[model samples]
Target: MASEPGFLPRDGLDRLIEVLRRDGREVIGPRVRDGAIVYAPIATAADLPTGVRDAQSPGAYALNAASSAERQFAWANGPQALKPLVFSPRERLWTSWHAPANGLHFGAAAHTTRPTAVIGVRACDLAALDLQDRHFLREPYADPAYRARRESLFLVAVHCTHPADTCFCVSTGDGPEAAKGFDLALHEIDAGFVVTSGSNAGAEVLASLPLAVPAEAQRDEARAGVAAAAAAQTRRLPARDLRPALLARIEDPHWQVVAERCLSCGNCTAVCPTCFCNAEIEEPVSDGSVSEHFRQWDSCFTAGHSRLHGIVVRADTLARYRQWLIHKLATWHDQYGRSGCVGCGRCIAWCPVGIDLTAEVAVLCDDGEGVAP
Candidate 1:
């Protein structure tokens, strides 16, 4: 291998697994579960779902059983992202009491998920992580829990060999190929892995693994393979200056059509890696010694998402739906300097109403009267 950061045989994966397990780290990777590939406790690399394809539809997903066991990772995204595990669904923010010692005690939380190894993370998911870093870690009010998990865990990113129809990572300026921020980025080369370091952390992981530096020609092949995987993606969105377009169409008739089937379920935001909105619920103790306020997932589709003085802004479904789409595609760029969506397509597959983003965006970009209520 020439420009190969390092080439490791399949046995090297086994060695890496042993290293983590020996150190009491829980190894989580993709495994076949009820016909789909899910992140679960993997004892060995052999347990991973190899030579299988995953079929996904809106509100429905079926993992395709391998025909001859020649799996090239034929799925797009999974039901869950690495987000929930990092930023929990609910968390205790603070404790309070109205007694002589009237004071607020902030909750002490950490990832504490055991020294773990996450394998087979895709490129788009990695991109989502970058966005999360900005939102959760880079903010003035940095989330200590998120920072803890991010620091403790080791990531092994897998370069895509096949992309799904629902994936539009190219349009979002991300990838169907692993780019950066990984302890190890693996491109399947023949029966081995062409590995590269995304950072100093990645290089350290490599130093601990058994690998061979590839020849220069091998590097070009590895690069070409990544490019081909990206080209294989069939989904696309014309996001050229999409933010301004969304702002201009706040009152577009298309939103009404979208709202009809939109269910206000908040599925889109939940699956989106960058959509970070939460609500707090407090529990009052009878003793008055302590009250716990919990931060949990919240969505704009719900009425409570935009309530002030007991009055709700964008009370109707149409306005709520418009707010979500506009903010995700447009205003997010204004605020974060990056688009909120990584084009992972989890929202498309998980929406119970089958409200496809690409389909709705097309309607929004149009100048016609949408389906009237």
Candidate 2:
């Protein structure tokens, strides 16, 4: 073991897991679940899915077990991204109590978090993490919950060498490989994994592992494997920057065509890693002495999301669909200086109607003129 770019043998993954656990960090990684690979608590390297990959398309996803015993991490991405773990789906924001002395007293809610180390994080998800950081951490008033959870977490990014049919990270300039933001990153090869540390914490952990400086040949092979994966991606947004095009076509008829098939189910937003929309819920206690406020994930497709003064702003399905697309591809740049989408393809994979955002973008851009009624 040394504080340098090295090769961690396949068997050394167990040691890495054990080291994290010994340091009082709960290890989380991808695993076989009901039907798909999910990020779950894992105690051992054996918990990782072996010879498993996923076949994905618009509105369709299926896990196909591979015959190759060598490819331990064959799957590209999962439905759940790293968003939920940090920016929780549901959380108490505050609580209020009423008393005779004071009409109402507002106080912060209690939140508990644990030190975590996430393995097998993909590049697109890493990009999503950056977007979330801008929204939650860079604000004038930062989200305390997200900051606490993020500060205590360790990230182990995995370079994607087996992208799915729906993958487009390469087009987004986010993946096939990770350039930064990971404590440690790994590229799986035939012999083992080529590992590198991007931070002091990552270097400390790697220093304790049994690793060797990867040979020049091994490093070349790892680079080649990642390139091949990038080359394999077939689906992508028609243009790298769709903000201007999408904004110009806000009145495009393509919205109506897709809205006809869309359920307004909000499936895409739920699965999207970068969608930060949420709604607050207030509940009164049985005695009406206290009220608890909670924040839950919300979608733009929902009618209530656009309601104002008892009127739904974007009442129709077409309007709602257009709002989502515009926000994700057009206005997101104005807000965050980057596209909200990381090209993860989770929206397409999890959408029930198989509504492909890339396809929708192509249609909207095909004919700039608004269609006549």
Candidate 3:
């Protein structure tokens, strides 16, 4: 019987990267790039998104200089999650030339598992994976690539100590602390971290590290740190029972309020770790003989996302908007036994129209009209 496992603070969690690198795993983490935090492969601990914070609101995001001189990990999530590595933005399916005997081609050519480690995964992203696991891994038709990447990867979730103004994971019921699904969960405590292993795999990794057992007081501080993060959340979406609220008002007029300014740019879906609609295209690689087809990320905001035949299912912006929100808060439960929104607030920050799903939920939860007009 596997039970919860805890580890004491070490010299620095930055050393954990050295441990992973020794095992030949390529570590991808958030790094400061072009005035924003972006996830990329890093060789050292210094590349993390340190000191800088992100100022976010609906339809807006700007980098704020580090609050204190030594703050490296102070920031909200960036414009991207760690999705592109797994569900690439574009991938060719297969290509074939004008030859009958060329044989049919297959998409996503063979690739080796690199044993990658996502070092600085946020609580929201981890929650989104919980939803995605049901859709892509637990479903009848499991996605092989997603399963392979998910199974092979090592997850290190960082609990929020400081949150962005736009952050509302608590509203969607997922974050500020890593509740589950981590090889190692980290709570940044000044120079070191409070590390806990949530699974057997996590404990295996923990056993190899040279660390210290936290005193009872430090354990209490760790718990307080997690609680402080939840308390620091400024924006909140406080709806729990969604079945009665959202499914009841599928055709409400509030959809129009948000759709009016929607540019359909698809930034919301791109940033949303849980929005997993995709499309595939075939293209030639080098030879017309050997062609490849690629599965690329798609979005609900795109006109093609709802295309059935020559007609689109949700034609009007209002209908599309309603479909998105309903799928997020209501029907997703039917499909995956959970709400689609993890409350990461990336959608709120990325929405060019500044449409907030929490605000939308508040409208419906209170007035039964969905988003307010």
Candidate 4:
């Protein structure tokens, strides 16, 4: 295990991937797919999205060529994060069948998870992962499937140097630099990467690579890049702790104004890294001899989410939107000791009509005229 920071030449990225693969881990990294950057299986450094930069704004995302051909992590992030890797989009919980000899029999679904190493992870996403860890791996009640996948993951965090216009991780204290919760952390520079290890497993991997002590100039460049990224952000929440302020405005007229633009399509929740709502469903055979129960990702925006007895709570779009916003920005603090949002801005960028949560929150926090009771 290395005690000092190491520099891995640009070409050495392949060696890193090879090491992870040799350790019997599936290497997943960012790649260009369907007009956007996304996580996919990688075999070598060439599989990464090199020379790609992304442009993001409210309800819009575009990929453009970068000036340098050597930079693979020049983009902020894609729509998907580490959420799908651990908390699957859908998974079977159990299967049940009725037998003549026995009244009924139930068996838990069988599943297998391969150790996976995910590279090019961003700091804000690491923050989101921490929240997900708290939700799924908490004591007294932990999700077995999520725990299995989570335990098998090896995280490689890439500090964000190029931030999108919609990014505001700095305001949320979640990004621009990855502080912890990673096996390895990479600070990408023009010629190479300054690499460091956060865990014992990460140290072992770092020690295996043919690395050099990072030059003072490379260290300086990495620091400058992260600082510039923080400064480049143009969007931010009205305040860090908006719980009291947001809860006070439950009936604010701003909800109605925002609802006009919101489609309640659940796109924000879909892309949001920390939103963890889910629904349990059952599938039965035609003869009803056997049934399979499963859990799938759900959203608060859905009409059925609030259904109780025969009636639906928060029936209108306004109420659903309010519940979502409040839970994300305000109530999450009480539940998780921090805001649910990691300030990745995926919600703003992926929104079809370009509804910006930061802008909406600013308006709601304003003590202006027309604020309703």
Give the top-scoring candidate (TM-score): 4
Q: Write the per-residue lDDT of candidate 4 for residues 292-323, one digit (tens) a residue.
A: 99999999999888888979897989999999
lDDT by residue (tens digit), candidate 2, 20-125: 7766899999998989899999988889998887999888899997656767788888889899999999999999999988698999977688899999999999
Kindly list the per-residue Cα lDDT of model 3 for residues 1-373, writing each as its tens digit.
1334354343455667777775678888888777667889997777776667788888888887755545555676888876666666765434444556675644455544688888878888888887777877766888777777777788888887667777877767788787887788876665466677877776777776766766666667667877876777766665565867777887777767777878778888889888888986666656566666678888887788898887888787777777777888778878877788877788888887887777777776774332223
Residues 161-213 of candidate 1 have per-residue lDDT tens digits of 65665677877778878767777788775557788877665676677789887
Q: Model 2, stretches more than 4 Å misplaced?
A: 1-3, 367-373
Scanning candidate 4 in windows of ten residues, the lowest lDDT window is: 364-373
Q: Which structure among the candidates has the greatest lDDT? A: 4
What C-alpha lDDT values do all the predictions have? 0.75, 0.87, 0.74, 0.91
Q: List the residue pairs that clash in candidate 1.
A: 1-214, 1-215, 2-214, 2-215, 2-216, 51-71
Error of 1 at 10 (Å): 2.3
Clashing pairs in 4: none
Ranking by lDDT: 4, 2, 1, 3
Candidate 3 TM-score to native: 0.88
Clashing pairs in 2: 59-354
Any idea what lDDT model 1 has? 0.75
TM-scores for all candidates? 0.88, 0.95, 0.88, 0.97
Tell me the lDDT of model 2 at 372: 14
